[model samples]
Target chain A: MLVQFYNVSKVYPKGKALDDISLKIDRGEFVFLMGPSGAGKSTIIKMMFREEEPTRGQIFIAERSLVRMKRSDVPRVRRGMGIVFQDFKLLERKTVYENVAFAMEVVSAPHREIKARVPEVLRMVGLEDKENSFPGELSGGEQQRVGIARALANQPLLLIADEPTGNLDIDTSLEILDLLIDINRKGTTIIMATHDRELVKAARKRVILLDKGKVAADYAPGEYLVC
Target chain B: MLKNIWYFCREAVKSMARNHLLSLATISTVAICILILGMAVLATLNASHLITRLESDLEIMSYLDKDLTADQASEVKQALEAIPGVESVRFVSREEALQYLQDSFGEDRYNLEETMGKNPLPDGYEIKALDPHQVPVIAQQVEQVAGIERVNYGKEMVNNLFLATKWVRVLSMAFIVLLSLGAIFLIATTIRLAIFSRRKEIYLMKLIGSTDWFVRWPFFIEGILLGTAGSLIAILLLAVGYETLIGSIQSVPFVPVLSNRALLIEVYAGLVMVGALLGVLGTYISLNRFLDV
Candidate 1:
């Protein structure tokens, strides 16, 4: 298993976000987590990156339990994973190239590697010509594409995206989804959280329907039972 | 590692450029604080030097017995010189003593010579002690020497100089420490504002798996640069101001300040060290509060 949530539960002062949730994702699998706003999809994504720890039980990535890991070791674990946010958190001050290059720079990647790989990743995202354009000048779709390219810069094995297409129109949403699916097909395990039922039904991959804080249903391709 | 430090330095320069006004404010505040502190220190140093000169100038004048011959007076001078704390002993004859009186009397030299037919001034030995504090003990020993009448040194003058310089030193030291702390607080506030403006960058760095140290290095470098720059400015101002002060007060012989070459190097070096120390300390405080990963 590349990722595991073993009876993990998160309880805040207000209420429980995830109540005894247990799931496993295999290597190179594309999984969709579907639910309403309060269904703990984001919490699961946060736990995978060790951003929020489980209030009870444990989580592991590549068989290493993150609960017992030292705080200093969190960065190393996170480096092996890429994350994308719902609102397309691209730095407004940075150009598309700088936005993507920032991830590599933070890890102290060599200048030559950064100079070479940034353009390649921009090309992969089909924004090669827009490398110098700042995020403020780009459309919503283009900004999200820059966000994806930045996430992919480090070549992480696991890509956890929270509502990746939440802010786009139907056409743009499909385009972004197709890009994610293509990236997933190229041997990256992708777990995306979304509330768009139509997109979920169309993708038809391994769908884990989260209701209230627990996994309400789990189905494979061609076996999804939409609510 | 060298490349990483170079990156950090570059980032620090970039950050300072981004927040130019705040950086300037911090540097100016630090410079002003150090300037006041340096001035206080210099004042204390000059006061202390003057007091030391006054103390060293203290000497005991030992008058000889009236019936003592010239040979006996020379023997007394040699005996006083042999004492442990005695620096030197010079025997002044009656004629030389009269000439000293005449020189001090200036225009009244003839009137004094006519009024006093005989030279009543006694032959005495002027005794200088190695340690000014040991003057009383040396004076007592000189008075007990054979053919010596009495030993005289200005006790009250030495006591007043010690008391006055002691207070000056204590007050100036307290003022310097307080001002330094105030300067550090202002420095930290300036860095804190810089940090506040770029908090999003910090958050992004942490989210993207940058180590705590990687995110902190730039800010650390910024703090150091601010501190060192402020100290350099303060030192320059102090050097110019002190030279001017010494120039204008050249006629005041009693001041007895240290020469420019000596005091300048010492004060400049001390200010630089203090500025750097405060910079590091201010950075530590700010980072400790905001840079938690």
Candidate 2:
């Protein structure tokens, strides 16, 4: 398994965000975590990526103990995974090329490697022509494309998307899903958090359902039925 | 790192250009502070020059006692000239003194000598010394000269000059410190406000994973620009002030020392350094408050 969560629970003093949940996923698996808002879907994905640690229980990534990871190793852990955010958090000041290139820059990729890899990732997201465009100049869908390109820039082993297609239209959303599918088929483990029902249902992927911070059902080829 | 600094400096210049009003106000503040400080320095410098001139002019004029014989007075004059502090002694002969008195007063003072039934004027040695500090000590020792009756130095005038110059020195040092601090505060606050305004950019940069130093470089460079610009402004102001003063002083040939170019250059360079210090200090203040957090 590339990621494992053992009795993972997160408490925020007011209430729990994720209840005692245990799940495991191996390499190259495509899983959809479906839940309505505040169902702890994002928390699970976040914990897997170490964006936010579980308040309790052990979370593991690539057989490494995330709970015991040193502070300096956080970036190293993150470098091994790709994250696509819902808000399309592209650096507004930076161009599309620089936005995608930033991931490579932080990992200290050599210049020649960045030059070759950036355009390739952009091409994967179908944003190869908009390299010089800024985020504000791009439409929401196009901006999200740039965000996805940035996430793929590191050619990570694991892909985590938190509501990745929230702002896209139906057709645009499917295109983004297809991009994620393409990436997963290339041997990257993918965990996508979403509230979209039709897409998850039609895709027939393995689905984990959460309700009130606890995993309500784990279904193969699941739909958003637990809601 | 040099590349990073270039980017930083470029950003700094860009910010300075964009925040034109703020930059102008800060630069003017620094210029005014340095200008006042530079003037005080120039004053003390000129005062020191004047003191040196006065010290060089000091010569002890010894009056020979009327009862002394001509040859005895001559011998005492030679001995007085040979004293350690004594550089050279100009003997004011009685006849020469009489001629000098008549020439200065425009009257027949030579007739008063006949009326008094004795030559009132006595031959005296005008004793010179290497330093003004040695004057009192040398004067006291020379009082014992065989034909000398009095060794006077017009204590009232010399004491006033010393007191005045001592006050000028105290004022100069105090003024310099206060004005430099003013410049620092102005430039620092300016940089802080500049950074505060661009805090959104800062947060965006941080969120995008720029290290604290990389995030701070622009503001730091802005500070360097402020310092460099403030100093240049201050230097310019000082030059204008110096020229205006020199123009007035030029017609009056009595003020020869203020015409020095080397001292003026030194003062301008010093103001430039003060500006640089203000720039660095201000940037540090802003960065320490904003970036480290």
Write out the backbone clash pairs for model 2: none
Residue A55 shift from truth in candidate 1, angstroms: 4.6
User: What local lDDT score does residue A138 receive in model 1, on the 0 to 100 scale?
Assistant: 90
User: In model 2, what is the error at residue B23, expressed in angstroms?
Assistant: 4.1
Look at candidate 1 and give me any clashing residue pairs.
none
Q: Estimate each model's TM-score.
A: 0.86, 0.68
Total clashing pairs for each candidate: 0, 0
Q: For candidate 2, what is the TM-score? A: 0.68
Over B1-293, each residue of candidate 1 has an lDDT whose tens digit, in order, gives 88799999999998899899988987897788788888888877777777788888888988899899878778887888899988888878878888888888887537566788888888888889899888888888887899898778877776677677789888888888888888888888878888988887787778789998998899888988988899899999999988888888887876576776866697789888888777777777777666554
In model 2, what is chain B's TM-score?
0.82
Can you list each candidate's DockQ?
0.54, 0.14
Best by DockQ: 1
Per-residue lDDT tens digits for candidate 1, residues A70-177, read: 989988898888888889888777889999999999999999999999998898889999989999999889889998998899999999889989999988888888
Q: lDDT tens string, model 2, A143-191?
A: 9889888878888888888898998888989888888888888888889
Runs in model 2 deviating more than 4 A are A1-94, A98-114, A144-227, B17-33, B55-134, B137-148, B207-211
Each model's lDDT: 0.86, 0.78
